[model samples]
Target: MMLAFILLPLGRMFGQQSPAMLATVAAMPDVQGAITLSLEVAMASAVIAAVFGTPLAYLLARSQFRGRALIEAIVDLPLAVPHTVAGIALLFVFGRNGPIGKIAGQLGISFWGTALGILVGMLFVSIPYMVNSAREGFASVDLRLEKAARTLGASPAQVFWQISLPLALRGILSGVVLTYARAIAEFGAVIVLAYYPETAPVKIYELFLSGGLQQSSAAAVLLLSVTLTTFIFFRYLAYGRAARKGRNQ
Candidate 1:
């Protein structure tokens, strides 16, 4: 039943779109631009998630504070929030007139229809994936190994860098892949927050609305293929010999 359910749709989508149509959509300037922008912004968002989320994940995994559960819930809040509502919430907080936006405006940083806005929208929804993945990764590392290192006169920082980090790297890499994929697939929040600079998902949506299913299918197929390829490739890297590469590095 599961194979039938999944494979049917997959086969249908692949068989439906003509190569000529896919080529046409691929050649469209807007299509190219949207794909480029989505990849670029998604990469940037992954970097941001890594830098900002790593510490939070480490803290959550290692510490046991009174409000630890609450913090975890907060980190996962965006997953519960409707994405469009998430966009609206972001607008309220990051719009030109909003408090943070106003302060940023004074400092020459604007989140209005810019890459920064798109990034914020993606980050809001996708960060939990990275944080949770990384936390689990960190948690899976043996504490005894850390303690043993400590007894050997290694400081906490050294233990974390040399021991905990290396062992948990696969999990962290998984989080990064998921984070990038989530950011790329993002649409609802991005539509409201960064409509001007349309990502591939947004472009496909606009095409669907303005043109129709036939018109949208080509671009849709391209995006689906790209995302699926990336997912498959990253998963391969995360789970197999690629996992070893991260540790070696």
Candidate 2:
């Protein structure tokens, strides 16, 4: 049932497109541009998520505070929100007359209808993956190791850098991979927020609308291929690192 439900549709989609058709679509400048944009923005979103989410993940994993549960709920809220609704919600903050948007305007930065908007959309929906994964990673680290480091007179910063970060790296990397995948696959929020600068998903949607399934299928296949390839490669690297670390220990 699972195979029929999951693989059948994907298999049909792939089977519909010949290598030549896929090649033709891949060669199209617009297709290439959209895929490139998606990869770039998704990578940026994943990095931003890592930098910003790591502290929060660590805090959530290690701390018990008055509003910690509330914070966790809020962090996970985006996953529950529909992407289109999330986009609409973002527009309130990132729109031209919106608070952040107005302030950003003064700084000559705009989110609406731009790559920044796409990044925002991607980050909004995908950051939970980073935060949650990293939190788990942090939580999985044996506290005794950190305590041992502390006993050895390691500063808090040094303990975190030398002890916690490396142990949590696998989870962080997994989060990054998931975040990138989710960001690249984002369509609803991105289309709502930055339709002009179409990412691969948005471009495929456009092609579907204007040119129908036949025209769009090739591009879809190309995107699926790229996404799957990158996902597999990164997952391999993450797991391979974990294996090496295990052996070293």
**Best candidate per lDDT, number?**
2
Residue 135, candidate 1: Cα error in Å is 0.7
Residue 171 of model 1, lDDT score: 82
33-84 in candidate 1: lDDT tens per residue? 9888888889889889988998899999999999999999999999999999
Model 2 Cα lDDT, one tens digit per residue, 1-249: 987999999999988887877777888999999999999999999999999999999999998989999999999999899999999989999989889999999999999999999999999999999999999999999999999999999999999999999999999999999999999999989988889788998999889999888779999989888889999998987788798988999
Residue pairs in steric clash, candidate 1?
none
Give the Cα lDDT of each candidate.
Answer: 0.90, 0.93
- Model 1, which residues run further than 4 Å from truth? 242-249
Model 2 per-residue lDDT at 246: 86
**Model 2: how far is 148 from its true place, Å?**
1.3
Question: Top model by TM-score, which number?
Answer: 2
Each prediction's TM-score versus the true structure: 0.94, 0.97
Evaluate residue 192 in candidate 1 and report its C-alpha lDDT on the 0 to 100 scale.
91
